[model samples]
Target: MITANPAPEAGTEARTGSSPVRAVTRRKKRQWLPYLLLLPVVVAELLIHIIPMLIGVGMSFLELTQFYIRNWTAAPAAGVGNYRFVLQFDEASGKALLHSFWTTVQFTVIVLALSWLLAMAAAIWTQHAFRGRGLVRTVFLVPYALPVFASVITWSFMLQRDNGMVNHVLVDQLGVTDERPFWLIGDNSFWALIVVEVWRLWPFAFLALTAGMSSIPAEQYEAAAIDGAGVLRSVRWVTLPNLRSVNQVLLLVLFLWTFNEFTVPYTFFGKSAPEQADLISMHIYQNSFVTWNFGTGSAMSVLLLLFLLAVTAVYLLLTRKKDVDA
Candidate 1:
């Protein structure tokens, strides 16, 4: 069946003016590959993150019931109700907003200050002629290596009311106290949280500062030394100033973490519920979980988010956003 043999395939295509499948394939690849590669991430983000956030935004302005059955079916708009309620929110929330704000502030400031101070000291120490400086630096990382939950438990045990290591050391071992210190008592819990918090997070600061110190160009410090800049002068003029961005970013991030952190305090002081230690996060839990007031609880969450956003924005603007690196 010599039926025109369809010419040769390429020749037939050329003659008949049909585009080859390879061209179609290449065209598809050129037109769609990038987007196809991007599709998974876009889909994942929409499903996992974007949808939840939109739901939260919608819920923040709604009065949906527990099961979200749409009791009124009006799309549940609260307009500025949730926001206004939060701005004037007081009665049930107690001093929770204030307490959480201040405690978070206290925790963040101490962690930042102590972390940088200790880190800087250790960094400077390492730069000197010390035996086993590497080992010492490695040892300093033990606390940081402990997971948060384990660390919190360890600290709690140490700070417990009786037989705690801190009390044992300060009283029996050192003769510093007549009796065991009540570290977790209502009166002392706030400060106790602070102490443990600082201890647990200090290693982070130490590591960062140490790395920063090591990264400092040796030539710059050598020049400073040649100009008669002493240790303190070099740190103040060169080291600290150079660390500005890293420090700022760490401070803000740590503050946010502390602000929203719930587990440690919840585990340590729950049932006992220290008034001073009741941070906004805990308050949110109480309202949302304990009291099952989802509306008010969601309101609290929205408020806390707004507060953190504003605070972070203001801080960035004042310290970082406005500064030119020059």
Candidate 2:
């Protein structure tokens, strides 16, 4: 008691005052750490993708051609001229662009329908347990596993009109045609492109569907069986309902990928593609590189991008409605 009110413990007072402040500081640092780590990725994405896209958009609004190719900055501004020219079908060039776009749409629709069907069938078939199931699954994935370039090149060789395995079997063995049809030229090129694309894309759909199938509860199928539901009915009522979300996403992805497809057609048909198989991608390529009309090519690309965005928005809205109804 003689300690003159016993000096307030200085150390304890300091600890109590600073603890809250220290905690708040640590939390702020922790929160900011993830953003700091992601800074590099954001910057890389901007530099690689966004910047080029902006540049292309800018180029679309300018008259960039071989005439001004040396110095693109000095190219005259075209404003909406390029877009108008592309959209108007009265002109010969515009007609060609429209035709190419229609061809692409047809190809995308056909490929998407066939690929999705085959993949779904394969996925459902492989879901059931059986001897050699693992082997079958692996075999199903081989087309997707192989390098696209090598596989496409091999297909190109095999599709040759003169001395190719496809024609060999059709003509020599089966006597389907007296003369070897030109698979890489004229209208048949479209069919050849579709066949090759279906082969490559179905495997991807198979993989996606298989993954989706794995998450489906086994009890659902069991209940269906107990209710005396057959395999087809079970699929229609149970399996499809469960796989709806997956299929929605898968269909959208396939549509976008197939619509923008370039490599398969390009590799199959080099600098020159037949009118029947001249996809929008190759059309843009020819406009930009072969014809040296960068401005028109950029405009076409921008239009295609906008169209795809609209399609995606509509698809999502429709799918969301279906999900809500379900």
Candidate 3:
């Protein structure tokens, strides 16, 4: 006689049927896990950057001076009046802004050229195996590693007209100057700013260039040497060609940073930096905080933002085109 098969237990059947559903639920959760992890970062960016930027753009359209600062929302709308006032080149405010822009352009070009030159030289010098190469590399990084406030403040002291180390070296030690020339004022202030900024900036460039050089094969240099290539020729052909991508990114970052530099000038000259050394960033600060013209300052800031965006777009476009052609 055939034995009757026992009926499957109800709970066991339910568990067996629900296993696929549970697996589907777990898979759905895993699919959402990455987005959930990214949620906090997105929220933080919106809160810290996007919201504040929108507020600034809104304030740019309002007359948000000291008169309406307490109740900024109630301030009368100025529309494009602020932009017009700042862009009117014939007026004093416009003239000052134009001067600051040109001065910043000149400063940025000088700093970029000098910093890149020094960094490239140092990177090439340290590329080969030699005695104390590691020590030299460490020394090169000191300026970039130092705290900004501390290093720049020290430079401020050294650039002082009397009893500062710079003057002491130039006048007393080297006899480079007959008198203790003022370094933190007048036309000299521009050079002083350049020196301090170049000191602070070149180390980072050196680090970047050094990293790029590491990816260049030793055989390339050897081949160049066999062809009677000197150091300059080797760099021109082997090193620089290999480092095109790195240099493109490095130069763009340096330009943006130098263009928007604020802390160095503000710290070196307090609120009122000399006209010869007045950068656009400090000029905006003067308009906004010193003169309490928030609307005009905000307008200048928007113009600056637009200008930077345009420049960046053009730079990226040209680089991308070159990359495609290459």
Return the top candidate by lDDT. Answer: 3
**TM-scores vs. true structure, each candidate:** 0.79, 0.90, 0.89
Candidate 1 residue 305 C-alpha distance from true site, Å: 1.5
lDDT score for candidate 3 against the true structure: 0.90
TM-score for candidate 1: 0.79
Writing each residue's lDDT as its tens digit, candidate 1 over 1-326 gives 11326355543333223557766566556766768899999999999988977666667677644655335355467776765665563644445555666776676676567766776687777865578988987888887787767878878888876778888888888988796668776668878887766676667777776766767788888888999999889888788877776677767776777778787777666444577676668767775766554555676777788889898888887785445654
In terms of lDDT, the poorest run of 10 residues in model 1 is 8-17
Per-residue lDDT tens digits for candidate 2, residues 70-158, read 89999999999889988889988899999999999999999999999999998889998899999998998898898888889899999
Runs off by more than 4 Å, candidate 2: 1-27
lDDT of 1 at 54: 66
Candidate 3: segments with Cα more than 4 A from true spot = 1-29
lDDT of 3 by residue, 106-224 (tens): 99999999999999998998998899999999998899888888899999999989979999999999999797899889899999999999999999999999999999999999999
RMSD of each: 12.1, 11.3, 12.0
lDDT by candidate, in order shown: 0.70, 0.89, 0.90
Could you tell me which residue pairs clash in candidate 3? none
For the record, the alpha-carbon RMSD of candidate 1 to the native fold, in angstroms, is: 12.1
lDDT, residue 210, candidate 3: 97
Which 10 consecutive residues of model 2 have the lowest summed lDDT?
A: 9-18
